[model samples]
Target: TRHDFGSIPQGQVATAEITVRNTGQGALKIEAVSTSCGCTSARVEPTTIPPGGEGRLLIRYDSGLHPDSGPVRRYIYIASNDPDEPEVEVIITADVQEPTS
Candidate 1:
């Protein structure tokens, strides 16, 4: 659960979508979706997913709110009701750089 957005310039906003699939026998109920920091935010489509069904996790990271330049790291938390695993973690990274105009 890791994504690297190479070279995001200042003032730019980066976004990505992650797919969550339920391979188990029962339905996967997504309780909540959140980000580690204010600079990042996330949402999940269709909180309830039937077996073998998939859902999309929309993530947004605003470089302007990131506070600094260079390499940056953020996290996306997925709270769900799974027998073995209750919480899922997604990691996001970006090379925050100055815009070359």
Candidate 2:
């Protein structure tokens, strides 16, 4: 899944939510959630999702760590018990704008 935060001010923290659905017949258990860099963090609520149910993943990025104005991309890795897809990647993008003096 992918999420775009559009434009945000530098030094500000940005957040995005991603929904994970369990379409399979068995329950989905999220084993771990990790971010690509130290500037980003992610967590999954209700790590277990019943069949046909859904879960929420909260992702936070620290724009201040970038220290520049430009397009930024971050990734979140989700490890789950899904047999078909044990791992999934979520991408987040944003255009950081410089603060005015």
Q: Best candidate per TM-score, number?
A: 2
Q: Give the alpha-carbon lDDT of every model.
A: 0.90, 0.92
Question: For model 2, where is the 10-residue window of minimal lDDT?
Answer: 12-21
* Model 1, residue pairs in steric clash: none
* Model 1 agreement with the true structure over 6-89: per-residue lDDT tens digits: 898988999998888999999999998888999999988899999999999988989998557999989999999998889999
TM-score of each: 0.94, 0.96
Estimate the overall C-alpha local distance difference test score of candidate 1: 0.90
RMSD in order of candidates: 1.1, 0.8
Where does candidate 2 stray beyond 4 Å?
none
Candidate 2, 1-101: lDDT as tens digits: 89998999999999878888899999999999998999999999899999999989998999999778999988999999999999999999999999989
> In candidate 1, which residue ranges exceed 4 Å CA deviation?
none
lDDT of 2 at 8: 92
Query: Which number leads on lDDT?
Result: 2
